[model samples]
Target: MNKVIEVQKLSISSSQGCIVEELSLSLEWGKPVTILGETGSGKSLLAQAIMGALPRGLEAKGEIRLLGKTVECKADIEELWGREVAMLPQEPWLSLDPIMPASKQISLVKRLVSLLNKPKSESIAIDSLARFGLEGSEGKVPSQLSGGMAQRLAYLCATSAGGRVLIADEPTKGLDSSRKQQLIQLLKEHSNKGALLTITHDVEVAKALGGEILVMKQGKVLETGCCESVLNAPKSEYARSLISARNLDHQRGDLLPNHKVLLELKGVEKSRGGKTLFSNVDLSLREGEVLGLVGDSGAGKSSLADVVLGLVQSDKGSVVHHQVLTRPKMLKLYQDPPASFCQSITLAKNLEDLCKLHQLDRKDIPRLMSELSLNSELLNRKPDSISGGELQRFAILRVLLMKPKVLVADEPTSRLDPIVAGSTIQLLLEQTSRINCAVVFISHDLELVKQVSHKVVKISDYVANHSSELSSPLVTV
Candidate 1:
């Protein structure tokens, strides 16, 4: 096998700390390799380093060889990205231009190919869309498309312009099982023709791709081997934990101990533009129980969470709290952390304000911030000075301090790295358990839903059916 890419003693560091350190790996042409790690483990940074696109303030050392050619620095690696190596970002929405039509974005990619003297015909653009299950989305803007549709389109655009190596970062994060299967198949097809490297935390996805597995931690490689070898009998403890975490069977029959009803939605009916988003959607969340809302993008999942949070009004039906005819006591933690915080205000002031509004004492704010691993200095700094993960932690702390009866999280872990995502989930579960609060977790990651949620409710056929309520669970893929 011909080596398509190689990294030797690669190290990356930022002011926060080291991200990737002394990481060395080689990928062969016509093969698929998957990198697995928790969030903030430097998986994405490693990919960006290879693409010569590391963020500002990050420094790198060592060698990155592309097709046996050394790429020393950003300036030395001109025209290499998207030509020799293509990347599919973690957030599909961020990769797309919201105002531009999806088709135009594909056309732009085609034009870029042309500039490289490898022009693809206009028909290729449409054909690519069809291949990715986005056939009729040509005229639609990014916002108009569902999350799954946008993800598919982004994959199509990235893969359309041919490259020797493709780097896909959490490509299946927000997709349904069916779409995930499609993406896996597409990745297999790509790997059969060229080299492919997927950075993901999902073990099932990694196994399906059937490639060499690299398990990373804190910016270092812990284990590397065949998928079955590493997954079934991992040499490292971290690898063992990761593989164990992905097995859903271990979670079977695990129900919340306290099943007291906290929030109930009876015959909920919501509509938009005269079209029913969901009707007669019945759900009851109990103390210590997590209700997961799973569906493809635009499947009324987020809207349901919004309705629970009082951010959106339902067309009909009433929400009952603790068997009383009362509005839901919901607190929402947005996916984007910065959006939830006041930009100009210091972090301390924001937390103080939140504490004041909720009647929380000022002294408790510092302790809560520390529990979330936020520095006290951050309290004095503005939101602009903090990173996304830091801001998210702060937002979570604010919610924790408020101590709402019901928590509605809107894709809270989507933007985080795998380790960070897992940690955040654990924190939320722990806090909810301590407070005996019912949680409605809205997410695109099926693995996560299966893990944290006591009952899974998928948004299909316009009805919310609990896991126990159904005679047989429907596996869409």
Candidate 2:
């Protein structure tokens, strides 16, 4: 049969309301399908419902067919895992075993799901990682690898089972431009042998995949057609805005940062596992300025950010803040929102603790949530219960509540859709300007940094030596 996956009248609802309503679609082998939507627009809920992995308190109703055979609604889909279907998640590192070495994780999936012999699986795993430019990372655990490297390892594990159908949710989130195109090519190759369903906010990815496209908003499909039609000549206003956000430029930010220096790094040097990441780094961040940091995947951008925030110590040199800037007054927004919060506690409880610790007013949350487009109800749910985008916005709210003198935002808007991302960046600039907070904004998207940062630094420009196992640079633009 040509069809690998089909869903009819799929609906997902929670106590708050229906998240994904009456969605229907069909996927055929040798072709790919892409779903693009705003944050909290039910793209992820659909994927979970299809995989029979929806979180507790959510109910799904629909009929799913695998290889043209019908399955019960909300059926236990364990039998379909690996050999039938596999998923690459947004927070891929969360899916990987923290203690398992990179190569072993891939081999384990091959052995258990594809039923390959141990030696054969091991051989294939190493070869596969090399192809993905993870050759020297075989022994690295999830925590040891950079976010992009970890994401690549997770992808290897997901596809190792030879699943005929793949569901990739935000698969390219942490990748550099080159790595993103590489992964997209691999996904296209997978479609040649199976069916691929990609849920993402990146407009460029959907365009490159060149397949049927669906644009959803508020849990409803707003536009559907071939990629060219929906993206090029979109009938929906929101779709047009989404496409235009990619062309965002430097006009939105300050051209010169003349304010007082709030934080500075002097003769900084750091190395990991006998490999140098960056050295002799010097930079100054001024009040109300957005200092942008950009680099290829696996570069020491995050490490440098940690040094500035005092989360990590440098091997040589020092990080100093103005006397007014104290430990509690400097905060960092992590790359992964889920890892930043307590998974077992409700969002509200987390906020309550933050408020009590700082002796801040709880009334500020609602106003800030409104500014960030976060719903009041999300606070009642645990971190695991909310969508990635929603949780990311909540993370922003948390940082905004603190009103720090220095805010180290690591890819703050990476998880948001174009529409939401545009507004969110504007809000950050406005609020931070009002509070005179200096920001160290780390991102893989250099264009985004240019658009919103007062000054920019490319880590690649400062690298002493270049290799996959090591990369990092520091220079002030």
Name the best candidate (by lDDT): 2
lDDT of 2 by residue, 272-304 (tens): 767777877877778888888888888888888
State the lDDT of candidate 1 residue by residue for 399-435, as single tens digits.
8777667887767766555545666667777877777
TM-score of each: 0.77, 0.93
Candidate 1 Cα outliers beyond 4 Å, as residue runs: 15-17, 115-131, 134-140, 143-146, 246-267, 270-276, 282-289, 296-298, 313-329, 335-395, 411-426, 433-436, 443-456, 461-477
TM-score of 2: 0.93
Q: Which pairs of residues clash in candidate 1, taking residues 3 or more apart in a chain or in different chains?
A: 38-418, 38-419, 39-417, 39-418, 39-419, 39-420, 348-379
| Model 2 clashing residue pairs (backbone) | none
As a whole number from 0 to 100, the lDDT of residue 193 in candidate 1 is 82
